[model samples]
Target: MAGDTKEGVTLELVTGSAEIFGTDLQLNKKYTFPSGTRTAVFTYQGCTLELIGPTVHAYVSNNTPMAIFANTHAGLEDICRDTENGEASRGFVVLVVGPTDVGKSTLCRILCNYAVRKGRSPIFVDLDVGQNCLTVPGSISAAIVDQLADPVHGFQLEQQISYCFGSTTPTANMPLYELLIRKMAENTAEWMKRSRNACISGMIINTCGYITGEGYKTLLTIAESFEADLVICLEHERLYMDLNRDLPNFVKTLRFPKSSGIEDRSQNVRSYGREAMVQRYFYGTRALPLKPYRIEVPFESVEICQLGAEKLPDSCLPFGVSADDHHTKVVYMKPDMKLQHHLMAVSTAKLISPEVLNHNVFGYVVILEVDLQNHTFALLSPVNELPSKVLIYTEVVFMDDQINL
Candidate 1:
């Protein structure tokens, strides 16, 4: 797994009693051999590994060969292209934002992985006040403050920014993304000073999905602060585009919602098929002919009631809910249940965008049989803000249980 600098020459050490050399034997050179080497071999390295030995013994070790692109300076050039206009010390700043289950943290993990793989320490910062997946679950500020208080800790802090709210003190009403620009700059500067690693030159900030007018404002503020090089809007970007009438196929490729129950329908009951219809009704694109399951009731009783409806259509029960308003407005799940469930808010929140339904911390949707004894419902999203009350009716179906009409 190591690389060599000399073109067309490969160097490798053998663990067994064999010594091999690519160069000619020199009297002045020390012919160091493995302690237990009873044989010697030679090999050539190029696009592939070739083993040449005196005795024929071939075993590939079952190590799967990974396709790795050769390292090129083009990547550095691409990274620098965004920062060329900025100060020499300050590199490009990239921001990553998404909904609760859209894999914001996962994206951060990928970025960190890429950075570490490149022998760099990417200054990471988590601004998800809801889930704080990178930080402590509930204690967002504490987790971040503790890290800053002790930077030399044995724990390998994910080269991240504050994982909690930026404000040091909690207030009844504070500005969204408060202290973000200042904190990001301060912490990044601190890390740069402490660790003189050139790779620690860039910054990445992860944001919460619960972007209120205030939250969105905060995001724009931070972007302005850094004059960011790139803004990677994650999950919500698609929904936003669709609402704004500029949907991209890259976004439409996401899974739609589905029905939550149908495995126990009566012989004449075609609930799953009907749920599929509802999914098609809303999405009207490439919906599958199946329903997604009702995973969980992520919303609190108050939240559910506030949704303004408790019953869905007779056909799309437990998965689709229509507004009582005269608009015949309907909300339904995406066709791919598993993918939607994996990446979206469960149950009712499936219809809502992640930006409006940040439930990773305070609450989230869960799916399970309604009356099944001792069955557990899993959390689907993080609760970041209180939901607005809209006139809506919703219903979910379980094997033997039912929601009242």
Candidate 2:
């Protein structure tokens, strides 16, 4: 039988026939053997036959790394009945990566809750240091992690995840991300031994903030170290890794982005190495602008501003200038009646120039939009240029209810 190498399942031919006292043999491995079984037990590949009747001859052959097993007439029902041994071999390890406050901790909690509901326990590690968001003193209890295991239900292994916080350094490039991942894996492996009947089934490593350059490399290294089964990237679009491209190490990936809230916005900016004032600049720069334009979207509107690589027209843009150009600042003004708040959109294209575009002196722009309803703002894009339609919509005014000519 053939199985995934990562699954750690091996095919061993034991000293038994296809049927022993009416019990049939089965293999849930990925590949199947072609040869049929006979009355006498035979061995194939590295599998050995240890006969229990009289003379037990153990066969040990060195076969191919993943060769086809061409021996076995196990019944179809028996073959089908062999369930996937997800719990047998090395358990699954999942790594969650994304910008801060994007529900990484919340999702971890949910997963733990899910494991608990299924009578299984899960460990949680809070590595985010800037905000002790995960390790809020009384948030986690050791008693809960210890109780789920029992003699009757068998030891469903669950460990209280370890935290490696405060070691992350802004100067060291990628502060301890690799170290933290390695430590968690090693520690979980150690904990697995204590369980009476069960072993560590899986591990979840939650990452912090927008990882780039060294940090990104460090994250990849961590995933590889743990032989990660799944890599969950939250709000990955903002990370700019061209996630559409296939990654090497991780078997599967999941992307989930939470809506931007005030707390989320604050955390996102802080994670980008920006000071509070710079964050304020990107968010509340224009407390009062000289002249601002307006655009209106009714409650029916859902998707706003789907952008592309089109240069905006000068006339349709705010401040009578192209939003993509360094000299322009697109500020939107809305009356506090229907929407009950004012919205301001600003571009830091001129102030920082190439710095805003990470020193890529090309036609890059930093477009920031702020919704005043809940004091939430977003640094939307740092791309080639502004979209033509978006520029037009920015300058147009909403009269009565609809945008007017």
**Cα miss at 106, model 2 (Å)?**
0.7
The RMSD of every model to the true structure, in order and in angstroms, is: 19.6, 23.2
lDDT of 1: 0.34
TM-score of each: 0.34, 0.37
* Maximum-lDDT candidate: 2
Weakest 10 consecutive residues of candidate 2 by summed lDDT: 64-73
Winner by TM-score: 2
Q: Write the per-residue lDDT of candidate 2 for residues 1-405, one digit (tens) a residue.
A: 212122222233353333211112333322121121112222232233323222222232242211111111121112212312432444445566786556564454444433443444334444443432222111111112333222111122223342221123421223333443455556555554555222443444555564776667666666676566667677667453543254573367666555332133443434332222222222222221121223333322211221112445666667755454422222232322322211112222233222221111111112233455744322222222232112111211112121121
> What tens-digit string does per-residue lDDT give for candidate 1 at 1-405?
111222222223333221121122222222322111122232223122233222223333222111111121124334544344443544445666544445444444444444444455556665554334443321132111112111101113423333223121212123323443444555555664565443234655666665555656666665555445556565465534432342223221222221111122232233333232223322222211222333343333222211112344566544443333212222333222232221122222333432221222222222322222333323222232323311122232112122121
> What lDDT does candidate 1 reach at residue 324?
32
